[model samples]
Target chain A: MTDITNQSLSEIIDNIKTKRISSTDLTKAYIKNIESAKKLNAFVTTTFDQALDKAKQFDAKPNFDQLLPGIPLAVKDLFCTENTKTTAGSNILNNFIPTYESTVTKNLWDSGSFLLGKLNCDEFAMGSSNETSYFGNVINPVKDQLVPGGSSGGSSSALAADLTPATIGTDTGGSIRQPASFTGTVGLKPTYGLCSRWGIVAFASSLDQAGPMTKTIKDCSIMLEAMSGFDKKDSTSINKKKEQYSKNLKNNIKGLKIGIPKEYRVDNMPKEIDELWKKGKKILKDLGAQLIDISLPHTKYALPTYYIVAPAEASSNLARYDGVRYGYRSKKGKDLIEMYENTRSEGFGDEVKRRILIGTYVLSSGYYDAYYLKAQKVRNLIKKDFDDNFLKVDAILTPSTPSSAFKIGEKTNDPVSMYLNDIFTVPVNLAGLPALSLPAGLDKQGLPLGLQLIGKALDEQKILNIGYAFEKNCAFKNKIKKWW
Target chain B: MSLDKEKIKHVAKLARISVNEAKVDSLTKDLNSIFKFIEQLNELNTDKVEPLTSILNQSLRSRKDEINDGKIREKILKNSPKESEEFFVVPKVVE
Candidate 1:
């Protein structure tokens, strides 16, 4: 009836509460959609038979008090799901199945949501495009050949294509937000440690965070409320009580001071992006918000700093893949050391290898002071920029990316160029701040362009409110003509 | 700040990842370009700033040291590529 797959997560919850649609019916609808949209290459593994069984069990004894009730969601493969193959988009973990569940996924399951499947992502969440995934690049549902921005590319594409109602993604330097921008959806990278990194595959320990990607901001707030909490397992998790983000979401942002950082007006930015930024400002101002011109001077150093810090941590975190306890092991090695070398070299993809090499180089004895430590200090400056700016403003606004989504292989040859895709989004991660990317408008080619709202650390509610107000008032309507 | 083939090999060895002889040249070039970009951080002066190891300024929480979990030996061993009884089988180290 009227495409149950097209309804938002909140609406689906209501339909289930009212007994209008059975969980089995909802699960079947998504399965049908996912099967037809196989060309998108979004799902790495589909658990349809198990999903239907769970749905039937849910429908037999429905519970209305739970947040998700009886929803089935496909999560990004970086998370460790018990008894399920959680690949993290690398051949290294292709045959690996976990006996434990990631804290974030456990929280979702407790909220009455079950797994639909594991979605594809950049190997170890290393690249800006989905091309780095060993499972192959996920096609943007918006257009053929265009990348659905990545490591979270599969999550974004699946949501945008309506294969799953709502999904979760991990953001390390814009993995969640950038892809959300590309695919015309809502993605949030909550402050670092908001969601546990316990069972998730480690990328950069300091930067990796799990967040929700949804079709609407209200659904985003709802999914976020259900997913985030204090977990003793994740040392960095905020030990405070969970926030009632959806209930507290009020769009009246009158007199709220929103900062427009001057440094974000990067050199050679597209005219349409600039126009979108201006339009965003006007919408906020009209909604009774004050737009202050602010400066984040160290913004220029963020990407370079991130490249150093992330890879350094990544090299260390990834050293565990020795082919000893779990994952892929090479048969060709002559001895223990040789086996370790062969397994990593063979299991990892090119982008993953490049990062590992960079990580190894930066942390190497001679280069430690010049590279890793220097970047860490510069990282402090980047954080201080936001810490100082948050004093004068409630939130900061910028364009999500310099431009819209590019072709899959567009910047594969140039790592630095691909890294530049996160220019506007990286600084937030470096500072351990929360930011949301909202689909604001379309570019000249009709590809979706997003506007980012950056909030202070632990201030997700403020940005969500501003984004909610902007989403309601902005002229942009997110409609993708389904060519897939 | 650039890496040569020999240095790339050395770093690959340190990282415990094998680098094929044919791939070393391109890997060196790619890594050199990334380093070239990273070199820009040198322009900023961070002399007095302490390194940011963790974003949360609070001290790590300490819990009483005690056994919290056990009895999942089979479960943990189930994921190993080569398991022998209760342990993971590895290449022999003792000569």
Candidate 2:
């Protein structure tokens, strides 16, 4: 038998359709692979029995119409999977098995995708590194014990390691793209409201968007097409006619205007990242795309604004996780007040608690106007920067992170330094635009460094098309040597 | 705008989270640094900018408010840490 686990998602789907590989056999191979790669800690919960059973179910009666019939894929634990434990990589919800499915996951299953397991992530999608995951840190497949960028770290790790063919991830601030850049996988943080946020565990209501992480851009487009739709359940879900992004991925980039923001040139950035950005611009330029040097003046303040807005929303959203409902509660509480306090104090990790405190402080009476409201207004300015740029350029290109993946415990002690990793990626989230991280080149350490393509809201196809053109031309080779 | 221990404790209290005394000193430091970092936003002059609550500038679509959901009492209560019949159990709120 061929190495089914090594096959790209599209290839796996094709093989299943042609009866060259039965869904059961393919799923069994992945289950074996996932079990052997346990040291990576990519998966928080493995639905092996469920996956095998689902594969068997699909094999019994193959459905040709289903987009991902019998294909095993890992879901970020952030998405609520009914009856399956959806921890969101936090101890607070370690036993939180939802009674309903998140719309994104529902869309995937409706397309005949079988669940391999719930992938690990940062706690409530808070940290830049997966270290904050209550389940423990996800090990990078590229190097032993290196950090897979987060809060969607496991999603990126699994895709890069080929433990699962494809996975879904949510990006609040660089969660999807940074990890993808770190692990040498492709991640797309689609335009806000592109995918419904109906039942995905809310981190930052305004910023969080569910997107796909895959080995190839083509797989990303297909998975994205399957995963997106408007839902009445999510008030923010955009009710626009969906585009066939996969079909519209034009390999030609002739006359496409790509913007290179001057503001992305920060102090003390790795020289390789600058070279990679230059390389990306050159590739687009060679393809007959006009590379314009533009200025997003408000870009410098994006991170600070993101920290304020995300934490504020997160604090509000996470307030529902008190001991009263479905999540964990403290065992040593004397009264309701004490119970609430104890439950949160005990259940949440330090990073999560810190964010909650920051959120509460900002939204509190005295500082609301100065901090929370000011952040919101500044957020508008950030969005306006992109809005103004989009009138001139079709898409914007920049470095995904300042550099490649760092070691597991590199910046864990310093929260501010860890937050700086998001400097390049947060602006897109703040502006509610779709963006993708493409592996452009590798650094001196042989670690994957990536470039981002930011597109106007609902212009996912444009970015995908641009990314496709780059992928075909650049041919960035970053397949990791199997160490496990 | 440096966050001190007292202010951090107050914020924690408002958030309904208990921060241990041992951790308060460090939490104060973390918040102060983060706050100091975000103070850069004050440099930009915004006299008339509106606070952007929603990124997708859309109106909230409303339907006739009615009891269309929540009939599955058993399923909804399935994951409750403490429940009695159909109600979620919590620490006593009233005497």
**Model number with the top DockQ:** 1
Local distance difference test, candidate 2: 0.91
lDDT tens digits, residue span A65-126, model 2: 77797898898999999889999999999988898999999999999997899999999999
TM-scores, all models, native as reference: 0.99, 0.99
DockQ of each: 0.87, 0.84
Give the number of the best model, judged by lDDT: 1
Q: Residues B30-90, candidate 2: write the lDDT tens digits.
A: 8888888889999998879998977888888888888887679888888899999789998
Chain A (alone) TM-scores for all candidate structures: 0.99, 0.99
- Tens digits of per-residue lDDT, candidate 1, A1-484, equal 7999999999999999999999999999999999999999999999999999999999989888998999999999999999899899999999999999999999999999899999999999988889999999999999999999988999999999999999999998999999999998999999987888889999998999999999999999999999999999988888988999999999999999999999999999999999999999999999999999999999999999999999989999999998988999999888899999999999999888999889988989988999999999999989998989889999999999998999978999998999999999999989999999999999888999999999988999999999889889985666776787
By summed lDDT, the worst window of 10 consecutive residues in model 2 chain A runs over: A241-250
Can you give the lDDT of residue A306 in candidate 1?
A: 94
- Tell me the spans in candidate 1 whose CA falls farther than 4 Å from its real position: none
Off by over 4 Å in 2: none
Specify the poorest-scoring 10-residue window by lDDT in model 1 chain A: A475-484
- What C-alpha lDDT values do all the predictions have? 0.93, 0.91
